[model samples]
Target: YGIAVDSGSSGSRIQIYSWPDPSEVSKEDTSQWNSVPRVFQQEDWSYKTSPGVSTFADKPHKVWDDHYEDLIEYAEKIIPKEQWNETPIFILATAGMRLVPKKKRDTLLETICEKVGKKSEFLLENCAEQVQIIDGETEGLYGWISLNYLLGQMDDYDVSSEESNDSLRPSYGFMDMGGASTQISFVPYSREEIVKHRDDISTVYLRNVGGGVQQWDVFVSTWLGFGANEARKRYLKNLINILPELNNSNDEDDFNTKAVNDPCLPRGAKLDFLHLKHSYEIIGSGDYESCLKTTYPLLLKNLPCTETPCLFNGVHAPEIDFQRDKFVGISEYWYTANDVFHMGGEYNFLQFNEKVKSFCESDWSEIQKNSEQGAYNNVPTSILIDACFKANWVINVLHEGFNLPRVGIEEKHSTSEEADLEYKPHIPFQSAGSIKGAELSWTLGRILLYASSMIASSDKISVGIAPASKENKPFVYGGIDNPSLSSQLGHGSWSFLLLFVFLGALTLAYLYMYKRDSLKRFPTIFTQITSKLKAKYNHYRYLKLSTQEQTDLESG
Candidate 1:
C-alpha cells in the first residue's frame, strides 16, 4: 500500500493505492505476480480539496495546518495501523508550485517536509525529495506510465531484451493539458531520435517480472504557455495589441478606449477585458471559421526553429509516426470533448470538427439556455461560454501545431504494408478522464514506480519476515528491517536473570512447604531421615580427606 498527493494547480488530490505485497504473495507464484505492484482500487481511495498548495506560499505553515493535515488523517484511517510505518507518502507538486517564486516554493516544500516527517507515521527517510515539486517532464512521464499501466500495456515484458524492449507492444504517448501548461510524453521508436533529442528525453526505471529491471527512454516536453487558459490569455492580449490597428488610430488613448470584437466567443456574449486598470468590453462575432484561423496563429508555429523539426514556440519534437504510436489525452482534452461535444474514445477529426463548429456557431442565448436547462450536463456558464474557444484551441494545437494527422484530411506518412489503415476515418489518439472506475492520474504511476524500485533494491523481499530469524530468535513486533542488536541483548539478559531468581524462590517455597507437611504427618520420619544422613556422612568422612581437600577437588 502507498499514498500519493498530486498537488496540481487547482487543488491537492490524495490517492491511496493498496496492492498485494509482491514480497508476501509473490514467493510461491512468481509468474502470477510481476515485480509491478498490481494495484487494487476502491471507490473511496481518493479525495480532492481546493485552492491549491501554491496558494499557501505566503503562509507556508498554513499548508500543514489547513491543507495536508486532513489529508494525512484520512490516509491514516484508510490504511491499516500496522502498515503505517512502512506505507510511504509522496507529495508531488505540479504546475501550480512551478509558478510560485523560488523562495516561496522552497519555503512551502520545506514546511510540508517538516510537517509530514514529524507528524505523520509514514516511512519517509528522504523528505526533501519525497515531498517536493516535480518538473513538468517528470509529470508527463508519470502520466505516460499511468495510462499504459492501467491499460495493461506495460505488463508484456520481453525477456530477450535486458535493458528495454522497444519491439514489444509500444507504450502509448501521453498528452495532458492543464490550466497553466501542457505536456507530451512517449517512447520514441528509434535510437537516432533518442540521440537527436537527448535533452528532451528522460529514463524511467521500472521492475519487470522476476525482479528484473526495465529502463525506458521516454520523450517528454512541456509547453509553459500552451494550456487552454493561458492560450486564451495570450489570444486576448493579441486582440488588445491589434485593437489600435483595426481602428486606424495612432493615439494610445483611442486604443485603450475602444472595444474589441472576439470571434472565439458565441454571438451576444460580452466580456470585460482588463488591461492596466483600463476595462475594455469584448463583443462576440460568433465566427467559427474565423476563430479557427485566429487560434491557429496563437500556437506560434512560425517561431524560429533552432532544430530541424519544431512543433511550436521554437520547441523541438520528434516526428510522431501515428500508425505505430498510439496516444491518450487527459484533462482539457477529455473535458473539452466530453463535456460539450460528448465525444470520446478514438479521435475522429471530421465528427469533432462538426461538433465544435456547431457549438461555436450557436448564439450566446442558446448556449446559456442549454446551460440553464442542464443541457450541457450542468456545466458552469463561465466554462460553457469558453467551450467554443477551447474546442478550437485543441483542434489547432493537435492538428495544426503538433502535426497530428487529421483523419480523412492529412497523410499518415507510414511505409507499413497496412499503411492504408492510417487514413481510416480515425486516428490513434484516445481521450479519457478515468478507466475501470479509477481516476487515471500520474499519482498512480509514481506509486507504481516507487514500489517496483523499492522491491528491486531490497535484499529481503518478504517484508514481515524478521532478519534475525536465522539466529532462532522470535520475531519481534513492529518491523524488523533493521533491529538494534544491543537493545535485544540488553532485554534478553534481564529476562534470563529474572527467570533464574523466580526459579530459586519457587524451589525454596516448595521445600519449606514439604518439610512443614512432613513434620505434621510423621514427626518420627525426620529422626529416621537424620540418622540415615548422619550414618552416610560419617562413612564419607572416614573414607575421604579433610574439608579443604574436598573443597580443592570440587574447585578442580
Candidate 2:
C-alpha cells in the first residue's frame, strides 16, 4: 500500500492505494507477475482539505499543527496499524509551491519532512527527495503516464525486448489546464521527432515487474500564465490598457469607480473588476465573435519563432497528427465542457461552437433564470459567468494555438495533412475528469513509478519497505524463519539473536504463570520454569509404563 498527498494551490488531497503482495505469487512464474498485481485505490480511501500547503509559508512552524495533522491522522486510521511502517507517504506540491519564493519553498518542505518524518510511521527513506515541489514538466509527464495507465493503453505489448513485434500501443497526448499554468505531454510518433526536440523530451524508464525495463520518450512542456484564470486576467488588463480614458483618472475616488464595455461577458452582465489597486465595473456586450478575435491574441502567436515548428510563445513541439494521435484534456477542459456546455467526451467543433455561441450571446438575466431553474445546478456562479470565455479559450488553444484541426471542417488545409495521412474521420480529442471511476491525478503516476522502481530493485518482490538506515538498523520480529518478513522489514542480522532471547523470556513467564503452586519461588522466572518442567517430565515417565508395571511401582 502507498499514500499520495496532492498539495495543490487551492487545496491538498490524500489517496491510499493497495495492491496484492507480489512476493506471494510472483516467484513461481514471473511471466504472470504483471497480470497478478493490480494497483487499486482503496474504497473510501481519499480525503481532501482546503487552503494549500503554500499558505503556511508565513507560519511554517504551524504547518503540521494546522494543516497536515488531521490528514496524517486520517491516513493512519484507514491503513492497518501493523503495516504503517511499510507504507510510503508522498507529499508532492504542484503549482502552488512553484509560485512561492525558493527559500520559502525549501523551508516549507523542510518543515514538512522534519515534522512528518519524525511523527508519522509511514516510510520516509529519503525525506528530502520524497517531500518536495515538482517542476512543471515532471508534473505533466506524471499526468501523461497516469492517463495512459488508466486508459489501459500502456500495456498492449512489451517494449522491453529489441526484437519484439511492432504492435506497441500508441500513447495518447495529455493536456492539463490549471488556474496558473497549462501542460502538454505525449510520446512522439517517431524517434526522429523525439530526437529533434531533445531539449523538450523526457525519457521515462518503467521497469516491468514481470521482466525488463520499458523506455518511453515523451515530449512535455508547460506555459506559465496560459491557464484559463490567468489568461482572463491578462485579457482584462488588456481591456484596461486599450481604453486610455479609463486610466486617465488621477483622482483615487474616480479611479475606484470606472466602467468598461466587455465583449466577452454575457449581455447585461456586471463584474466588479479589480486590477493593480484600482477597481472598475465591467458591462457586457455579449459578442462571441469579437470575444474570440480579442482572446486569440492572448496566446501570443506573433512572438518571433526561435524554432521552426513552434506551438506557441516560441516553444518547440512535435507536429501532432490528430487523426493518428488521440488526446485527452483534463481540469478546466473537463469542467468547462461538462459543467456549462453539457458537452464532454469526444470534442465536436460544431456542437461546441454552437453551444458556446448561444451561451455567450445569452443575456445575463436569461443565464441567471436558467440557473434558478436548476439548469446550471451545482455549478458555481463564478464559473457560470466565465464559462463563455473559457469555452472560447479552449477552442483557441486547441485550434489556433495547438493547431488541432476541427473535425471534418478544414482537413485539406491542415498542416498535418500528409499525403500518407491515415484518414480516420473522428474527433481525436477527449475531455475527461476521470475514467474507470478513479480520479485522474498525477499522484497515481508518482506512486506507480515508486512501486515499480522498488519492485525492480528488490530481489523479493515487495514495495513500501523503508530503506535501511546506516546508524540504527531496523528490528524484524519474525527472525530467520520468516526471511520475507525480515527482508520486508530491512532488519539487521543482530535482530535474530534478540528475537530468540525475547521468545525464551516469554516462554519462561508463561510456564511460571501456569504452575505457580508446584514451582518454588525462584529469583528468576527461568529457574521456576525449569523446576516446573522437571516435575511434569517425572509424571509423564510414570504414566508411560504398562498397567502391571504401574501397579507394582505403586505397591513399592
Candidate 3:
C-alpha cells in the first residue's frame, strides 16, 4: 500500500493505492501487467480538503495537524496495523508552495519532516527524505508518464529482430491545468533538442517491467500564473497596466465608483471588480472581435521569438503535433468544458469557439436568470457570471497558445516536410481523468516512476532493517516485507520507541485541551450557580432603601 498527496494551490487530495507486489507479476509477458493494477486503481480511496497547505503559513506549526497529520491518521486506519511499518508515503507540493517565499517554504518543510517523520503510525520509510516540493519539470514529467501509462504506452513491444509493426504502443502528450499554473508534457519522435527553452525538455529512462530497456524523452514545461484562475487575475492586471487612466479616474462622490469598459464581457454588462487592493467597475463592451483583439495582447504571443516559433508570453515550446500525438487536458480544462461550456466529454476547438461566442453574446441578467432557474444549479453565481470570459480563455489557450489543429490535422501541411514528420494525428485527445473507472492524477505517475527507478537501480532488493541513525537513515521502498513487530519494536527501536513517545505526547495534548476546555466552562457554570446569592444581596439593599424612604415620609 502507498499514499500519495497532491498538495495543490487551491486544495489537497489524498489517494491510497493498493500497489501490486512486484514478485507476483510476470516479467516475461507484457500483457500480464495490468494497465493499472486492478486492486490499486479500482479500490483506491480518495478525499480532499479546502484552503490548501499554503494557508497554514501564518500558523506554521499547525501545518501538520491542519491537514497532513489528519490525512495520515485516516491512512493508518485503512492499512492493517502490521503493514504500517512498510507503507511508503509521499506528498508533493505544487504551485502553491512554489509561490511561497523560500524562508517560509523551508520552515514549513522542516516542520512537517521533523514532526511527521520522527513520529508516524504507518511504515513511512525515510519519511523526511520522501516528502518535499517537486519542481515544475518533475510535475510535468510524471503527469505525462501517468497519462501515457493509462494509454498503454509503457508496454514492451519487440519480437526478436522483426514484428516491429505489430508491437508498437501509442505514446501520448499530457496537458494539466490548475488554478495557479499549467503543465505540458509529451514524448516527441525526434531526439534532437527541439524546444527553444532547454529546460522544457525533460528525460526519464527506465527498463520496462515486462523486460526491456525503455527511454522516454518528454518535453514538459510549466507556466506559472497562467492557470485558469491566475490567468483571469493577470488578464485584469494587464488591463490596469496598459490603461493607467482607468485607475486614476473614479467618481469623486463615491469611493467604490471606479468603472471601466471590458470587451470580453457581454454587452450591457456592469460589474464591480477588485484587483491589487483597488476597485473597478468593469462595463461590458460586448464586442467579440474587439475581445479577441484584447485577448491576443494578454497572451503576448508576438513577444520577439528567439526561436522559430513561440507560444504566448515568449515561451518556447516544441511544435505541437496534434495530428499524430494524442493529448489530454485536465483540471480546469475539464471543469470549464463540462460545467460552463456544457460540453460534457470530447469537443473540438471549433465547437469550443462557437459556444464561447454564444456565451459572450448572452447578457449578465440572462445568465443569472438561467443560473437561478437551475440551468447551472451546482455552479456558483460568480463562475456563471464570468463563464464567458473563462471559456474564451480556455479556447484561446488551446488553439493559439498550444497550436492544436483546429479542424482535423491541417491538410495544407500534408504535402510538406511537417507532414512527413512523425506527427500523423491518428488518435486525437481522449480528454480524461481516468481509465477503466479509476481516478487519474499526476501522483500515480510520480509513484510509478520512483518505484521503477528504484527497481532499475537495485540488483538484489534489500530492506535495510538495521536501526538507521538520524544522520544516515535506511532507505525503505513502498510496501514490502517488513520486520516482525517484536523485531521492529526492539530492533528498529529508534522509530518504534519514538512512536510510543509520540503517542504519549498526544495523550498529554488531549489532557491539556480537556482541562483548558473545562476551565473555560467553569466561569459560565459558576455564574449560573451563584445567581440566587447575588439576587438575594440585591433584595436586602432594596428593602433598606424602602425603609429609609418610609422614615422620610413619616417626618414629612
Cα lDDT tens digits for candidate 2, 269-338? 9999887677878888999999999899999888877676778866767777776788888888888887
lDDT of each: 0.71, 0.70, 0.61
**Cα lDDT tens digits for candidate 3, 1-556:** 7778899888788777775555455453457432333236545478787778878766788887777877777677688889877767777788877777766775676566556665675544332335566666566776776666665666543323223443324577888888778878776644443333344444454433543444445666677777777777777767665564546665552344367778787767777778767778888866666676677655667677666557777766677666666777777776777666655345465666777787788787787777777776379976766666677777677777887767632222222211111223464643554554556688887667545533332344431111112112123233333234343233454565577578756765775777666656666765774565434433333333223321111000
Model 2 misplaced regions, further than 4 Å: 28-37, 160-168, 245-257, 408-426, 457-556
Candidate 1 least-lDDT 10 residues: 547-556
Tell me model 1's lDDT, rounded to 2 decimals. Answer: 0.71
TM-score of each prediction: 0.75, 0.75, 0.71
lDDT value, candidate 2, whole model:
0.70
How well does candidate 1 score on lDDT at residue 92? Answer: 83
- The C-alpha stretches of model 1 lying farther than 4 A from their native spots are 33-35, 161-168, 195-200, 245-258, 408-426, 457-556
- The lDDT leader among the candidates is 1
Candidate 1 residue pairs in backbone clash: none
